[model samples]
Target: MFDCIIVGAGPAGSTAAYHLSNQGRSVLLLEKKSFPRYKPCGGGVSPAIQQWFDFDLTPVVDNKVNRVRFTWKKGDPVETELDTTEPFWMVQRDVFDNFLVEKAVEAGSELQDNSEVTAVQISNDIASVTTSKGKFDARYLIAADGASGAMANWLGFKEAKQFLGAVLEVETAVAPAERNTAKFEFGSLKNGLLWCFPKSNGYSLSAGIIRGGKGKVKDLEKQLTNYASELGINLSQSQFYNYPMNLWSSERQLHQNNALLVGETAGIADPLIAEGIRPAILSGVKAAEAIVKALAGDRNALAGYTDTINSEIGSDLVLAQRLSGLFFQFPGIAYRVGVKRPYAGKMMSRILCGELRYADITDMAMQRLKSSLIPGRG
Candidate 1:
């Protein structure tokens, strides 16, 4: 028997394993894919995430960004240069996830890659997990699998609201080669945004629509090719990859019996921006802490984990849901105007960076929007 059995060694699972092992607890991390396998993502890391890990930029970062371009169909695209020392780092997901797992192993956690967990059951304060290799038992279990996580279903968690995210990313040799900026095009489709992020060797472009319809990489191909043409560039020779966008909130109750949930299995992705890496890491840490505390004497340790996450990230998730819903509802020129406004952009940035709490904004806006009628309120 092990102290803890963690399913899916992604950001959340690795984070929890690292923290638990650091505290002298035995931890086992299971991953279905082989180590260093490619995972689909936007490949952009916020500067804030550097606080958690000792990021060796030279080894993984493709480029640094200090400028952002925002565009809309109503007018010419506007570029904003944020003259700050801080730069957003672009990294490949395979390298990033492997680095996180390596840290956990260094801290004493045991990792099992290419080990598919087929079944999970919790009884008498112990979790029995059956993987392709064999059966293992542990006092605590964490489901850190991605959006299609089977563990969530096994635990009877409700399905997330469906949202479509289709992105075709590729690196191509192109001119104007200073890869130091990211471009975002808005109002292209309903609840959709297009992205262009530069890497050290080349540039990557993506077009995506969330919650509008099923995303097909083939359909995105034309959009990306058209965008490249407008920039006087061609990506006919680049390597292409696709990843799904899962931006839904998991049910509030993430714990049942004795099993706990983390990462996408817990619905940690931000609904508005579809950002998950940072939140997944934080949730993993919190889950480990809660389990540890509960083992020491708190019988309701899993419940505490749920409360801690809700307290820390609940308001943000709420605001994200509300804002995404509002954006999708309007889907017009006015929405683009709001995004281009420097104040709105900064406020949104603050929320994403964890510098501001959504509850504070809610309290302030309640008075102004109260008369306008709010959804979900009778």
Candidate 2:
């Protein structure tokens, strides 16, 4: 039996594998898909993730965008250069995920790609997974299989509510100006937003109803098409995908028995921008630490993981949730008062890059938004 079995090879799972193996624990990482697989994402990652490991991640980062351009319904742009210690990173998920998993393997963690897990259970206090490849046993299990994965259900955690998110990716040559700027458009999707981040060889355009309620796939695709058209991109050579995602809604028990949840499976996606990579990696790092402690007879380690995430990440996201509600409800007004200011725009970028916290600026932002709604201030 392995010390830990990590489901899914996304940032969370691979990160756990690397750390656990580095600490001399046996880790087995199972992935449903082969290496270099694509996922529907905007591919925007905070460069702040560099603190997690000593290995070089520069080779996998496709682009680093310093400039940000925000628009309201494809017009009235508020553009500025992000003033953070490091620029935002743009990556292709396939490349980035594979690179991390490879690092884990290099660190003595075992990886079994294309091994789709069909069943999971806890028997005799050992967590076991029955995959298409076969059954594997572990002292601990990390459910990092993402929002759509069934590991949460198998582990008996009341699943988080999810909404459909869509992405349209296109491969084409881009000018240097476009490559260096990350783009966002508000008021194009109801209660949601559309974002485009550059990849080394292409662009991934993502849209989702992040605040609340469900979204029709057709509606998201249509809006993305229109947004692409407005950006002068050709639709004939693009691929579109739809996936379900869960954002942080409430604090819940993330640990059960010897099993724990991480990444999207743990409902850690950012409520405002739906940022996933940094949070997923952060959860993975913490999960590995908690499991290592548990293996050493730390009785409260797993529960502490839950508490740490709830307080550190969930608390911040709660602020983000409130801000997201206010921002999405009145996109036009928020764009004018909150985002249009050059400093505010840069601060938003800083938040995304992990340099700033919502708690740092949300109070002022809330007052600004609330005041703008008064009389003729807007």
Candidate 3:
């Protein structure tokens, strides 16, 4: 039996495998899809994630964006140029995930791709996983499977709240000027927002309904095509993809017996911005740490993983949820009063980059926007 078995080779699973293997533990990394498989994502990630690994990650980054442009219904643009030491990184999920897995392999973890897990059971402190390829056993198991995956339910966790999100990938050559800018368009759809991020050769345009609406979540074709037209882009070469976003809705236990949930299976995506990769990586590292402790005879180590996540990142999501409700409700007013301010965009970017916290501005922002809508509630 391996020391640990990690399901799903996304950012979370690969990260856990890397850290665990580097610490001299045997790890088995499993992926349902083949290497370099395409994923529907915006591909924007924080540079702050470099702190988790000791290796250089520049080889996997496609572009570094330092400018943020915001618009309302594809008009009235407000731009912010970040002055931080490291700009946000844009990556293709296929290359990025494969690179992470390669790092784990180099660190002594075994990777098994195109192996779908058919069954999983934990009994007597042992995890028995049966996949399409074969059956495996491990001392501990991590369910890093995504939002649509069944690992969480099989392990007996509550169903995480899922929201609709869509993406359009256009592969036309991009101008150098547009390659460094990340654009966000507000007020284009009901209970949602749209964003377009630049890659080295092309762009990823995406949309999502953030504040709990099921009305037109799946009807994103109209929203994205119209937005693309406004930006003077042709959609003839665009590849459309949609997926469910499992945002971090509430704090809950992340461990059961010798199994733990990471990435979307844990419902750890950001509710406000729909950022998944950064937090996913964070959970992976923390889960590895907990399992290592469990092997060393810490009875409460697995439970500690849940507490660490709640205190370190989950609390901020609560503030993000509050802000999301008010912002999407009065997006126009919030845009004019909040997103247009000189320092507003910078603060939001800093929060996504892990350099700032929602606590620093959520109260002030909610009060400001609430007063704008209510007229006399100060």
Output the number of the lDDT-best candidate: 2
What lDDT tens digits, residue by residue, belong to model 3 across residues 127-171?
999999999999999999898899999999888878889999998
All candidates: TM-score: 0.87, 0.98, 0.98
lDDT of 1 at 258: 73
lDDT (tens digit, per residue) of candidate 1 on 1-378: 888989998888998998888888899999999998887676776656666655444466666776777667524666656544466667777887898899899999999999999999888888999999999999888898887778988978776655555445556664554476677766765566767777755666766565565566666766666666666555666655555555644338777777788877787777766677778888888888988886687888888788778767765677766756666556553344456556655555555455555566654433333423446541
Worst lDDT run of 10 residues, candidate 3, spans 212-221
TM-score of 3: 0.98
Higher-scoring candidate on TM-score, 1 or 2: 2
Residue 272 in candidate 2, Cα distance off native in Å? 0.6
Q: What lDDT does model 1 reach?
A: 0.72
| Model 1 RMSD, rounded to 1 decimal | 3.9
Residues 1-378, model 2: lDDT tens digits: 999999999999999999999999999999999997988789999999999998989998889999999999899998989899989999989889999999999999999999999999997879999999999999999999999999999999996989779999988877777989999999989999999988777788999898767789999999998888898876677999999888886787999999999999999998889998999999999999999999999989999999999998889998998999999988899998988887898899899889999999999999999999999765
lDDT of each: 0.72, 0.92, 0.90
lDDT of 3 at 163: 85
Worst 10 residues of 2 by lDDT: 228-237
